[model samples]
Target: MLPSITPFGGMNLRPRSSGSGGVEEARNALGQRLRELRRRAQLSGKQLAESLSWQPSKVSKIENGKQTPTDDDIEAWTRATDTEHETEALLASLHTLEVQHAEWQRVLKAGMLGHQLELSEQDAKTRLYRSFEPAVVPGLLQTAEFARALFSRAIMVHRVPNDVNDAVAKRMQRQEMLYRTDKAFHFVITEAALRYRLCAVDTMLGQLDRLVSLTSLRNMRLGVIGYETQYVVDPRHGFMIYNSDLVRVETYSAELNLRQSHEIGLYTSTFEKLAAVASYDAAARAVINRAIADLASAQPEDGE
Candidate 1:
């Protein structure tokens, strides 16, 4: 999904905020701590850089949060500042920051096509996919038109490079895994997903038709949580659980790749709770059909 820092004894394990600002803020906090250590040793920036054999700009960048320090960099900084005891804690914060938050601008730097390919690689390694979506269809189940619409919006909103056609093609390519007998897919989506007007009416209709056809697949199980179903747990956000180990959660500005055992367990339990209240097979198709009917009714007749 996406890719934090803390203090010596009081490490800020959680992000300060939900946006990319939180990550940037955490990095700045780390830099401030390192700068404090340097000052406590009575070393000027250039002197510290010289002692560490790093360029003066390197010290400035790290101290300004413009550059993230490597493990070795952290070690050298701690040594030069006579704050070696802080090394372990600093390293822990650095690793946590690297592993937890991945901003969209950086993740999509090469373009959306690259991100799609990376997701494809992830899917290839996963045998059981359990996804819950409260807003839109999961990437694996999205139609080309729907995917195109989504990618176009992302490009505009995130100001990422425009590679919509390539990205859409790659997403369609990823769908080939659906037919693999070795893998199984179980997706639970709220009825709101089907009714969300993210794309044109015709495209939405076609997308719902695709969902209907997919329901009969031997390796795929689709579930629709209708409005009438009472949720056992609050569907706070959408997430995908790959097997039993990892959970991929997407936010407005970043993607969260949660790997902790407790985090995975919580999501797994949440998915089970959502899936239990959902309708499957014919019932799931009925939900899709209803959405299609609603859209069709809204369309003007041939004469008007």
Candidate 2:
């Protein structure tokens, strides 16, 4: 997936599950656990806050899942409530929640190849892939040269260890899933994505051509939203939905994995709205071909 065009925004470290309630449910559960510890210790919220030198509202926020507790906060809370034994378990839960909203640097700690493998594992489990992009081509549909360009930029920007070759190979390997008869893919991209000069003009032209060819796959659906189309919902950022179960949102700093049913439904609806205004089939090809022609025409003549 391509990074969002916007600057890094704060992330919600709340826990999420496969259940209907998703993040809120998991958050509330963690909060409830803390609340139970306090209650068992015979301490009121006000008393606990005062004991820990915290504002009374901090207790409420932590207990209500509005605020995530830091390790120090959890340790202090457990000690104040005479439930120190539960400290480790609570910290474990907190770490689990934190993993769901992983910073890109940490995710790429082992290098880009590791991250690509992680994506491949996720892809292996998904039977239906619905992707929407406003900034660049979706990773699964990206050609090798285009993928290399994107990966190179990511390496330079994030200052991660260089593994472009291995990472690109893994990404290309993942694309093999596209040929599987059991899976289906739906990709919606904006005309602006086609025009973005993220790579050499020649490489982008090849990528656009790749998109044109991908449209003919029996199980794949490609949608292109031209600039002339009026917006229904704001195309905030690109996201991928995997089989109605998971929504992967990439940001400039991190990746958000949303598993809540409601969140998935929201993205699903948004994708449908974007797809509705897209040009598909022959129209989609025409849009892609136009981009190709534009790039070709703009190319400098030999010796110019």
Candidate 3:
């Protein structure tokens, strides 16, 4: 059954302006919804605060969208205001936005290292990492030159960084998680994906060689899905499936975190379909070797 939503004592009821920036816009929107509900119920902020045993300032922050109300708070507010289904759903969306705007730097220093370190750390802890590569090599297996090329593009073309080398080094440092003694590693690749070179032939060759070496480790598993394979789940975009008592699927825009039983079940089902269509063990190694050979053959000899 859908939950109830009520006007929390502190939220404002006005629509947010278009000029609002960053997280403020989200908070303001949530505030406006709560405010409308409270007014409709003929409850003043002070009166509502009295009912909830909350300080007037707490209610004020919630109404102003400066503070996020908890699920319990929302439930209580909704009950107090006598709200129904649609109102509850609209209010629930605010929780998603608030959770998604994670401060990546803070997460990193707190030991997550943003998504990059977090992905590898989870893989190491769980012994499995299911990856779909639509465009480039997964960061965990990237070589220095290939990694540098990718970083150069981001820093120079995208203007996302001031120091290209520093960024590239950070990326390389993140890869160490894959090799940490405590966790096994599993990687799945596609033949077409491996063929699409991201750097010079030498760089691509080194990357492939690294892949070959890494896959040879007893605890490391590599799988290759050929273009000919028929996939039950034809996921065209790249995503990383992190398995560590939870499943996290990362996209370019947002990281989808799944811990709920139903959500985990869904991702597991999709991952199995992808695995079934992939080639593993020696067959996967052959694909990597072939790509490396093809890259070398295409390049001019060093003496020439």
Candidate 4:
């Protein structure tokens, strides 16, 4: 007999699991909308789950967006809550998300990860990229040499050997979105980043030069908070804010995304506090240039 297998080849085939930020965002948006409707209907999770013959845990999963609801679940929910028309409309709007998290083979076969990512990210009207590093420049502003060194370190030491060239190229390509008339990119970087030298002396100098050059763009802004300055916003984690609609926090094992109003408010406030303490314009540039010079000077004689 043929081995038992799922129609999708036993793969989860969930759209949010595709490792694409765009797909993830769409999934999250659907979840947020579902929770809002549930709240508006005044249906406690238990009540909703019981009415649909589902476990409370399952209801929680659907609302939290940990799991996607099938068509039957959606119909059951809408009918039970007396919001069939509104729910139907919401489902139509989110149909794209239903297929967003496709399998990796599908993406690879299409050979368009970069383009697809660009399309997804571009859908956002605005973006704010925040970075904190014990060492090394942020990828968005990194020079080729600096990027190579950093990738080597991450791959060799951290064992996260992403395709360095492909990843770097994707990052640089993403920067173009800042210049587009439709949207702009905002950057927040830690001063400690300026002090770190990930590559050779010359490469570090080149990277700093690039950073200085990019600072003049009208669509982009960079801020640096001196390490000696007391920080009012003490974030225990490092996160990136996307389009003011999503917060992505990073950890060694996985990433956490926050879209709930309460969490979003917390990060917004945290970012503002960090920005308040940061130095911008000439002051920030001066700090970066000085660090570059200091790193260059610390190198030994050519023959040594």
| Runs off by more than 4 Å, candidate 2 | 1-82
Off by over 4 Å in 4: 1-136, 157-162
What lDDT does candidate 3 reach at residue 277?
Answer: 80
Q: Give every collision pair in model 1.
A: 3-100, 3-101, 3-102, 4-97
Tens digit per residue, CA lDDT, model 2, 1-304? 3333411111112223332245456667889999999999999999998998889999999899987788899899888888898999999988776665566877887778988888878887999999988878888888999888888877787888999899889889999999999999999999988987878988998999999999999999999999899989867777788998888776666677787667888889999999999999999999999999999999998999
Candidate 2 all-Cα RMSD: 5.1
Task: List lDDT for all candidates, in order.
Answer: 0.80, 0.81, 0.61, 0.60
- How do the candidates rank by TM-score, highest first? 2, 1, 3, 4
What's the TM-score of every candidate structure? 0.76, 0.79, 0.61, 0.58
Pairwise TM-score winner, candidates 1 and 3:
1
After superposition on all CA atoms, how large is the RMSD of candidate 1? 7.9
Note the clash tally of each candidate: 4, 0, 7, 1
Better of 2 and 3 by lDDT: 2
Among all candidates shown, the one with the greatest TM-score: 2
- Residue-level lDDT tens digits of model 3 in 181-268: 6666666667866777456777778888887877767666677887778888765444455563454433322333445555456556
Backbone steric clashes in candidate 4, count: 1
Could you tell me the TM-score of candidate 4?
0.58
User: In terms of TM-score, which candidate is stronger, 2 or 4?
Assistant: 2
Model 1, runs deviating above 4 Å: 1-96
